[model samples]
Target: MRFSASEGLRTMLTAALVVLLLRWGPQQLVELSRVWGEWSAPQQATAVTYVLVVYVLLRSGRGVQRRVSWHLSAPSATALRAGSALASAAMPSAGGSLSLERRARHEAAHVVGFLASGVVVEEVDVRVRPDGSEGRVVAVDNKGLAPVEQAWGYLVGAVAGNVQDLRDGVHDGGSAVDMNTAQSQVWRVISCGVRPAGYDGPLTADALFEGARARAGEVLEQHRSAHEAVAARLVEYAESDSRVPLSGKDFDDLGVGRVPADV
Candidate 1:
């Protein structure tokens, strides 16, 4: 919601221009009509064609600019592929026997984070696989969020899981995928030219990841009760059927206040 001085000045100038146009627009339009009437049929056609071509070129240029900006900001294909491969490779194996309860808490934390940030979480699921327990929280891609908020959303799952693990005096090993995913998202945010608050270091994924991790931890700690309530509910669902995911409505029915208390 904040704007630089230059932006404020530009907005003021634009408003003034709009007011002037509104005052003089009728007279200008009448003058334009007079000139148009004086033009021959061929001259009118040529002018219309010229205006159309200029409009088309301007629109095409804007579209190309938008596309280039998006490409520059978005994560590269190689980074995405590497993140996926790393997530799969770093998954806990069957030998470790990851508990269903832990997986439930992990996914529940994600749901809490998304809901707190005004993102729409569709479902959360904890599955018991032969290799190990795994969980996922499916959320709508809310592109309207600020970059810092999006980074917090991405990092909160791992931060909350780690906090829980520390509380229980257990070694945490299930958040590799979460961290990997968060790092990639942080990289994308940095590429988009936004830096995390208090970050003055080189523009690297690691720096932003740490900043985002700390902020997510702070926010999750502030809403610890909500997270705990969600986690308990997820555990109850897993007890009945670990495969059945909890819908957004199910979480809403719990009556726990979202982290921000408002969307």
Candidate 2:
């Protein structure tokens, strides 16, 4: 990679300093001090200039390195969302008892959550296996969405799934990964200076998660019709090929819309 002129100078000076220290040890500093006292005025001026230039270059280089490292290590919002989807999909069905219909509804709820939260839904699908069933919704472009909104997007699936289970008189086996991912999103938002409403306590994962969970329920209730429509379509699609993914156009065709302005 190309480096700026200051960085190149800093590298050269750092190498020289290391070599000098390795060869001469602490005595070199004493020797340099003695030489500085004996030097003429012009010589002292030149040496001071060199030291100042080296110091500035080295400090700037450190700042540049820090920025590069941070950029390399920090995960983007899109990556986090995609990872959450993958984790949710890979989680085994609780007790190996979840039905294909339930899996579809779970993923459909996630799709509605994404749409309502202004997240882009690419596609969603479900797979049926003898052991259990799995479902996933592919979403992207959540960069500008509020942390609570993104957290809600991650959480709605579990809340809706549990609600469905309640209606069916079945025990709820919520996805732990979904809750963990939602909490992570909440933490990220708080770190970035966006605090969720009604949370005045010290920041904690559970607190952020509970706040997001409550909001998810509210949003889900508001968009219940859209969620039901998407779930019904997902069930119908499963009749032919359970693995086929439903696209954004398919959701749009089903009349899925954004979350209400007040919400």
Candidate 3:
């Protein structure tokens, strides 16, 4: 009860401070906005030009941000994603290397899945679906895309990334993802026949999903190695002054025509 009372007192004091600041802040801001009205004509022109320049710069910044994340993944999507990440932060065990950031862990895990299942990750980017849902889309730069963009292979990687126990095959789907639930979600996507543009139907969907799942399980064994590689590459990319081209077919190499796969 004492603790609650103290907390209440603190909250009231903070609220009082906010009220006081609000009471004192408006007049100064009002004066600042009016000072511009008294400027000489040349000074007014300069001020207007400055405002326009600032506006242009803001627009340019938005454009650059849009280039990375727009329709598929809005820049604002991070607001949603970061909130979840913060709410679900989990510290590692005593022996587990704590150096890996959550992003590094997720990127490493997903990258291994990408390599094993052949998801083609040269230009993977976040995007929003027409259904108003957010997800990622990876583009293959031909060099990285497997000859056969098997829907099952990609699906298996995704499922494995979602459900696999990264810790020691004994985890309960840490804050990152839930293994059992992840598997179920993957199955639902397949059963619903809602394949993405490239991974559409052949009848091999069911069989391939199972095969991919099994293959992904094997790939999980190399999670540590994969995680390490991901961390290294992430640092390498950060230091390098380069960008991955977003061109090329989503399911095939540049010169190589659409390589056929069995769904």
Candidate 4:
């Protein structure tokens, strides 16, 4: 019956907003009559408080309902529910096996989508500034890329690759990167450049992982078959590598030439 911190905050904010509008409505009308253009501070504060109270009551009710449903269902189907929940919870730690498999699928999706839509998921390049303090550096180029569905594929791939690298003891030369870093970096860039149709605002890595998490949940809940397919394929891909981390070099080993010509 407890609301999550995020949910609670949202509820409070929503209520505050409702209060603001309510309080402001009358004052705004009065201002119009008086040929004034501003709402009094008290009016604004009252409106916000009213909004916040309403929001909390509604949201808290929903949270209570969900908790009740989960508790009731747990006893009836504990094993299945617990198993699935465990897998979803442990997804962040899936390791080289899970990482490699997801990367392959994501890459394939990117390649396929790009061929049909002129959108790319990954970009690679080598850069040099001869006169600068540092020598030439190889960089994964994601610049000029517009955030799109393809970007999600790339974000998944980057995170998976980095995760696999870490699990297999591969070094990034400087500081070792983690799944969180990859997700954040990739998504932040995408949010800025891709500008997917309706999504707006400064994006964070948390948002990227959340999107994937939600998709995974949907597959498990609404399309078990599809979920199984993805899980099986990921497991298979991981096993194929003997638990080794797949990398830029791995692609060359598999005879997938360097970055695509257009890229």
Candidate 5:
């Protein structure tokens, strides 16, 4: 099976640790025997407790992370949510004057995620400061989307897009807000602000994202081609749109608020 560098290093370290302990364990036991009478009962208990704590951390640390995701800041859930929460809002402005390329790509990913027939392209109007900073504001346009598309097809596409946004060599990361409307809510219910299933920890932003991105294999294995087909269509649509071009749109449109790709 294909394994990551981290996994290989982990295995190597574990084996080395085992060997070290094997070599040192007997020597330590002999040393302990030499001092058994000198170590107090409380001191022995403390040593045992430390070993137990370390063991628990080693074995169940992952479980703790997965289970405690709700306690983590919403921004740390994954790159999808981090960018979406900012860019998809009703008013998406950056903390500072943002790059035109970053802005273009951010809009591109969401349009791809939520793309459908007859959707509205709500232009992202950011009021930049002298220093140039802003946040993201996502959109929800169902004005002409068919009701069925709004409920099902758009739903699948949204999940597909969300999963797609994190693949290797996609958009870097950007603040993209959510519109908080029914159409957007339906998609978010299934895709946004959720932790990766395989990882458990007190998630740092890095770990949460790494875990989410690591799902690329599973996501693509099952849904990659389908999502890519849709994203490709989106890129084609954007290329034709007056709004999309140049700066930094590495990969790359919209209709009425709708369901997902399943439809």
Candidate 6:
């Protein structure tokens, strides 16, 4: 019920990866152009535009996350690792504002889920679990984390494909096809869980060769940590807002006494 800290880190890492790929891919493409001189000026322009859009969206999202952290108390500094305002680059712009609107809704849902998860936005109580994990709502809200995180993943993967197309020459051999496949693969990994929808969890030559399930599982693991970090930060936010002394009986009530209070 709490946000997964690992998911936050995964989001940040994914954004960073996308930014790096978006920036570097174009540079590589441009350098390749010098040698190949195959792509026309229009093609070059389009490639550059795609790369720029991805990087810009990621950066913008990071900025917005920072700003909101400064102003709000629920999401917390976890934005540095697990937030999604900038992932909007992945959405379709031509579909009017529907995509953007969905992103907004998801963002709100994320914040609300954190609050609803017992963050106390004001207080805390704690009970230690027999398993040694503290019983508390100090975690960030990661409920439905898959949708938002996967959406961003899809965007990054798509940008990677677009870049690859430019590098390989979209018209050359199977360049465009490869790109499409990679993009689709990325989406499937994100959307279809550790396997594609209706995949029946059975391993086959194609699945093994594709490594789709393995890759998706890896992503999910990464996301798990980011979500936890985010959830912890949300607890910190609650502590800060409540102005409660984190070392007292009330702290136990708010679920902070049993855990290390490292906001």
What is each predicted model's overall lDDT from 0 to 1? 0.57, 0.59, 0.42, 0.36, 0.38, 0.34
Instruction: Report the lDDT tens digits of candidate 6 across residue range 95-136.
Output: 333222222222222222233222222222222222221111
**For candidate 1, lDDT tens digit of each residue in 74-157?**
543221111112223334444355666666666666666666655566667665556655566766544766655455455544
Where is the poorest 10-residue window by lDDT in model 6?
A: 254-263
Order of quality (lDDT):
2, 1, 3, 5, 4, 6
TM-score of each: 0.54, 0.58, 0.34, 0.25, 0.28, 0.18
Worst 10 residues of 2 by lDDT: 79-88
lDDT of 3 by residue, 31-114 (tens): 545654655455545445655555566679989888866543421111101111311333444545322233334444445555
Q: Clashes per prediction?
A: 0, 0, 6, 13, 59, 36
Top TM-score hit: 2
TM-score, candidate 4, is 0.25
Which residue ranges in model 3 land beyond 4 Å of their true spot?
Answer: 1-105, 122-150, 162-172, 175-185, 188-213, 220-227, 235-263
Question: For residues 1-263, could you state the per-residue lDDT of candidate 4 as single tens digits?
Answer: 44456655654564455445555676555533342223344444544675666767768998999999775443211010001111122323333222334433332322222222223223221111222111010123343544453344344333332332333454432112324433543444454555433334345555656553333222223323332343344345445544332223322222222222222
The candidate maximizing lDDT is 2
CA deviation > 4 Å runs, candidate 5: 1-98, 126-148, 151-165, 168-184, 187-263
lDDT-superior candidate, 1 or 3: 1
How well is each residue in 1-263 modelled by candidate 2, as lDDT tens digits? 35467654654564456445535677677666665576556545555566666667877998999999785555545633322243234444454566777766667767766676666787777665565666666776566766555544544433444444444454444555555555556556556565544445456667656655555566667877877888787777866675557766787865556665356
